[model samples]
Target: MQQVRAVVAREKDAPVTVETITVPDPGPGEALVRVQACGVCHTDLHYRQGGINDDFPFLLGHEAAGVVEAVGDGVEGLAPGDFVVLNWRAVCGQCRACLRGQPWYCFATHNAAQPMTLADGTPLSPALGIGAFAEKTLVHAGQCTKVDPDASPAAVGLLGCGVMAGIGAALNTGRVGRGMNVAVIGCGGVGSAAVAGSRLAGASRVIAVDVDDRKLEWAKGLGATHTVNGAQTDAVEAIRELTGGFGADVVIEAVGRPETYRQAFYARDLAGTVVLVGVPTPDMSFPDIPLLDVFGRGGSLKSSWYGDCLPSRDFPLLVDLYRQGRLDLDAFVSERIALDDVEAAFDRMHRGDVLRSVVIL
Candidate 1:
């Protein structure tokens, strides 16, 4: 075992503290990674708020890129010195989803069998099974998806979560196609990435909606052809106006609220898709839309789970696209900070002041 410094959250609504924790060597089917960069995502904030679970002293950080330090016995096709993005879902081949050839929806994923412990020997729970806000982390071998080393760690790390979800929501789940009209609600990192993804998928008109004008401007920079300030106007009507008064061909709801979802439901053209990529809290309840409206809306109402992405397939392809200049992953990273600044990053996130604040180790 090796001792390493990591940010740990001890209780709900409490601040995270930097402390030393023991990082054990990888066991069977696991690998130790030297973390290069990790992004501060909303999910991490949720975990700190005890929204995820009651696992105290939680080691919080996912959406990371790193170099493989060592491979445990029984691990194959990986070695030390490999550059990889850490993924939360390590598909278990025996799971029902995997057996059905949909490994992307693998019901049972794997994490490192051994635990990293606190100095007093208390076991620490890893956030998303990847406690990467540290110099080193251990994870299931399958969690490490190899990518080009030339790709910037901060940029590629975003692919491990929100960015990938947004892109895949458009390209994979929504099946956006050439000349399609796409409108994405919410102009945060995920929503902007969806707009970019729609453009990359050949969507002719990419409309972005947000309450903040600054975010709308940011969305346009990411390839949105039109921007709607939802705070100033009716989003559904604006989207309809932009798409010949019919509505967009596909509407992506990235805000994850009933209000935004209702707007998305009503803002799409007939027989159009509604992709719900935003996450909703447990307290939020569904709206009482008439069953007739559901029946009349002649298209799919889908929820995108991590954008239905298969990390092994999508991560490398996205990194390659980034390298080819077809995708601008770097544009998503607004700023970079050290590990100690994660709390401040969260503050910025709460204020909607930045797209993504990455932590460079």
Candidate 2:
């Protein structure tokens, strides 16, 4: 076992604290990662709030990049000293989804079998099976996707979650194509990424909608062809007007709320796609929308999980694109902070002051 400094949330609605946790050596199919950087994501904040589960003493942080420090028996293709981005989906090849050749929906993802423990020997539940808000973490070998070492850790790490989700929503789930008009609601990290993805996918007009003027400006910087201040206008109407009064070819909802979802549902052209990448609370439910309207829409309404990303195929490719300056991964990282500042970072997130505050180890 090795002692590593980690940020731990002992209970629901409590502050995270830095503590020394015991991380065991890799077991079969596992690897130990010496974390270089981890992004403070909203999911981590949700985990801290017990919105995810009742896993107390939760070791938070998931979007991360690091160097492999050790490899377990039976682990192949990965070795110590490899630069890697941590992924939550450690696909089990024999699962039904994998058998169907859609490993991105792998139902049997692997995680560390051995638990990291607090100093008192109490087992700690790692968030998203990663628990990367630490100097080091243990994960299934399949969770480590090798990427370009030259890429900035703070920037690349964001791709592990939010960025991937938004990009995937546009390119994969939405099937946005060249010359298509795309409108994205919400200009936060995930939404801005969708705008960038739409541009990369060759969308002729990428419309970005957000209530915050600052985020709207950021969206323009990320390649939004047009911007809508939703707080000041009807989002659906704005999107339609931007797309020649016919609505967009693709509408992506990155703000997980019934209101925004309804806006997306109505803000697309006939046979156009609507991709929901934003997560919603369990208590939230959709209001009555005529089933006739659903049939009348004549298009797909899809939900994107982790941007439907097949990490093995996507991570390295994205890293190369970032290297080539085709992808602006660095723009997603709004700030960098020490692990001790995770709480403050969370506060900033709540205030909508930053896109992402990464923790550099």
Candidate 3:
């Protein structure tokens, strides 16, 4: 066991504190990682607010990249000194999903068998099972996906969560293809990534919709051909106008709210796809729509979980693209901060002041 400085949320809606916590050495099938950089994501704030669960004294931060320091018994395909992106979906090979060769939807995932705790021996529930706001963390060996050592950790680490989710919502769940007209609602980190992903997938027109003009500009930088200020204009009508009076072939909902979802549902071409990648609170429910309209849609309505990505396959490919300059992962990084600045970063995120505030360990 070793003590490290980490950001901890001790109670609901309380300010997070940098506390000394104990991280146990890797047990069987686990690995120890020296986290190089971690992104301060909204999900971490959700955990702090008790929005995820009543798991108190949570170890926050998940989206991370690092180097392996040690590996436990029975671990293979990974070793000390490997540069890796930590993923939450560490597939359990024997699960039914994996048995069918669809590990991306693996129902059973892996995490460290042993627990990291506070100095007083209280267990800390790791955010997204990663808990990477510390200098070092322990995770299932399978969670460490090796990527290009030359890639920027701050940029590529985001693939562990939001970035990947946005890109995957288009590339995987939406099945965006060449010449497809795509529209991404909510120009946050995830929505901007969807815009980028649409461009990467060869979409002809990628429309970005958001209430914040600043975020809309960010989406343009990431490759949105058109921008729609939902607050200023009717999003559905704007999208239809931009797409030749039809609509987008795929509309990605990244805001995770009823209103944005409704816009996505309506702002798609007949037989177009709607991919919901946003994370909504448990209390929220889907909006009421006519069964007749649902039947008339004649297309897929899908929800993207972590962009339905398989980290082992996608991470390395994306890091290579970043290295090749074909994909601009760096643009997603708004600023670099230390572990102590997480609470302030959260405030900035809430105010739409930044895209991502990465913690440089």
Candidate 4:
């Protein structure tokens, strides 16, 4: 057993605190990772707010990169000292999705066989099955995807979640192609990445829509060709005007709100794709668009789960691109912080003061 200091949310709406927790040695098919960096994501806030569940004393933090420290029996293709990004989807090969060769949609994912607990033996529910806020964490061997060792851990760690989701939404779900027009609604981390992905896929114009001017500027740095302050203008109208009055070929909704979804719906050209990458509260429902409009659109309405990514295939590729300077992974990192600074970072995130505040260990 190993005792490590980690941030834990003990109750709903309570400020998170650093606690000493016990992590056990890796069991079969698992590996122990010494986390180098982890990014603060909205999902962690959701868990802390009791929006995810009533699971209290949650061990929070998931978007992470680390070095493998140990592996248990049956682990293969990974070793100590390997640089890796932790992924939530550790596909079970026997699942239906894997059988159909679509492991990205794996119905059964893997986590550490054992649990990390508080001093009183209360098991901590790891956010997204990867409680990486600590100095070290245990995870399924399959959850650690090897990436370029030379890449910056503070930057590449983001690929473990939001950044990957945005990029994947454009490349995989939206199928952005050369000369196409794309618009990303919401210029946060995921939305900015969507803009970058669209540009990388050769989109002629990438429009970013957001209420916050700062976030829009961040999107611009990530490759947005145009910007729309949705708070001041009709986003759908602006998107249409930017795309020669035909609307965008691909519209990514990253805010996960009904109003923004409606904008995305009306902001796409005929037969265009709409990819929803945001995480909405359970009480939120689909927008009240008429069924006739849905049918008349003549295009796909897709929900991008983790950007429809296969970590084993996408992580290394993205890391390489970052190394080549083709992808600006570093742009997403607005600040670097210590683990003890996470609470303040959350306030900054809530106020839209930063794109990402990465915790460096």
Candidate 5:
């Protein structure tokens, strides 16, 4: 057993505390990873706010990169000292989705069979089954994806979550291809990554739409060919004008709001794809639209669950690209901070002051 300093939310709406938690050795089909860097994400804040569920004394932090410290019995292809990125999805082969060859939508995912606990022996619910804010974490063997050791942990760690979601929203769900005109609504981390993905996929024109000009600038740096300031002009109209007045070939709704969803619906040309990668709150209602339009619009309307990504297929490739400087993953790291600064990072995130504040251990 190892005692690691971990951040946990003891109750709803309370400040997170860094407590000494006991992490057990890797059990069968599990692995222990020494976390090298972790990015502070909004999801962690959501968990602390009780937005995810009622599970209290929850261990937070998910987007992470680390080195494999040990592997348990029955593990394959991973060994001690291997550099890796941690993902939340650990697909169960017997799940219906996995049996049908779509493991990304696996009905069941597994975690560490043994629980990590607080000092008093109270079991702690690790956030997203990945409590990596600590010095070390225990996870299912499948959660560790081996990547190039040369890549920056702060940059590649992001591929574990938001970056992958945005990228997959374009490449997989939207099926964006060469010469296509794509528009991404919302210019936060996910939407900006969508813009980068569109460019990487060889889109003829990538338009970024957001209420904030600062975010739009960041989008341009990430390869957005055009940016639409939604606060100043009609997003749908501007996208149409940018796409020769016919609307874009693909419209991605990265802002999970009724208003933005509606804009995405109207902003696409007839038969264009609409991919919703943004997450909506439970209380948010789906945008009401004419029933006939859903049938008449004539294109796919899909929701991306974790960008519909299969970790085994995407993680290493993206890491190699980042190493080659073809994909500017470094652009996403707004700041490098210590673990204790996570609360301040969340504050900065809420205030739109940074893209990501990484905790370098």
Candidate 6:
């Protein structure tokens, strides 16, 4: 066993504390990672809030980049000293989704066979199965997706979750094409990444809609072709006006709220796709769009899971892009913080004041 410092949310609605966690040596099909950096995502805050579940004493960080410290029996293709981005979904190739060749939709993903626990031997529920806000963490061998070591760990770690989701929403789920007009609602970290993705995918017009002026400004830097102050104007009307009254070819709803979802619904051009990347609370209702419109709309309505990404396929490609300076991933990092600063980071995130506060170990 190894003792390491980690952020732990002991119970629902309680503050997280830095504590010593006992991480066991890698067992079969597992690897031990020394986390270099982890991004402070909203999902981590959700875990702390018990929004994900009632699971107590959760190990609460997932968006991570690390170096492999050790690989256990039967592990292959990875070794000590390898730089990697930790992924939550370690696909089971025999699962229905993987057998069907859509491993991105794998239904039976898993984590390490054994658990990392508190000093008292109480098992900790790792956030998204990747508890990365630590000096070290244990994960399934498949969870470590190797990336170029030259890339920035703090920036690339964001790709483990939020940024990847945004990019994948446009490239994979929405199928945004050249000359397509795209509008993304909620210009937070994920939404800004969507704007970047739209531009990368060759969308001629990428409109970012957000209430926060700061977020809109950040979106512009990430390749948004235009910006809309949704608080100042009707977002649907503004989007239509920008698109010659035809609406957008693809509308990404990155905020999981009924009102914003309705805005996305009406803001789409007929037959245009709608990609919902934001997570909604269970009490949130589906938008009350008319049934007739649902039947009349000729396009797809989809939910993006982890940006519908295949880590092995996408992580390295994105890292290379970042290294080439084609992708401005570093823009998403608002600041670099110590692991002990997680609580303060949550405050900034809740205020919608920053894109991401990364914990650098």
**What's the true lDDT of residue 224 in model 1?**
96
Candidate lDDT scores, in order, read 0.94, 0.93, 0.95, 0.95, 0.93, 0.94
- Weakest ten-residue segment in model 3 by summed lDDT: 281-290
Worst 10 residues of 5 by lDDT: 338-347
The TM-score between candidate 1 and the true structure equals 0.99
Candidate 4 error regions (>4 Å): none
TM-score list, all predictions: 0.99, 0.99, 0.99, 0.99, 0.99, 0.99
For residues 196-283, could you state the per-residue lDDT of candidate 1 as single tens digits? 8999999999999999998999899989999999989999999999999999999999999999999999999999999999999989
What 10-residue stretch in candidate 6 is worst by lDDT?
A: 294-303
- Cα deviation of 293, candidate 6, in Å: 0.8
Score candidate 3 by TM-score against the native.
0.99
Per-residue lDDT tens digits for candidate 5, residues 269-348, read 99999999998999999799898998998888999998999888899999998999899999999999987888888899
Candidate 4: pairs in clash: none
Question: In model 2, what is the error at residue 315, expressed in angstroms?
Answer: 0.5
Residue-level lDDT of model 2, residues 1-361, one tens digit each, is 8999999999999999999999999999999999999998899999999999997989999999999999999999999999999999888999999999999999999999999999999999999999999999999999999999988999998888989889888988898899999999998999999999999999999999999999999899999999999989998998888888999999999999998999999999999888999899999998467999999988998999999989999899888989999999999889989989999999999889998999999
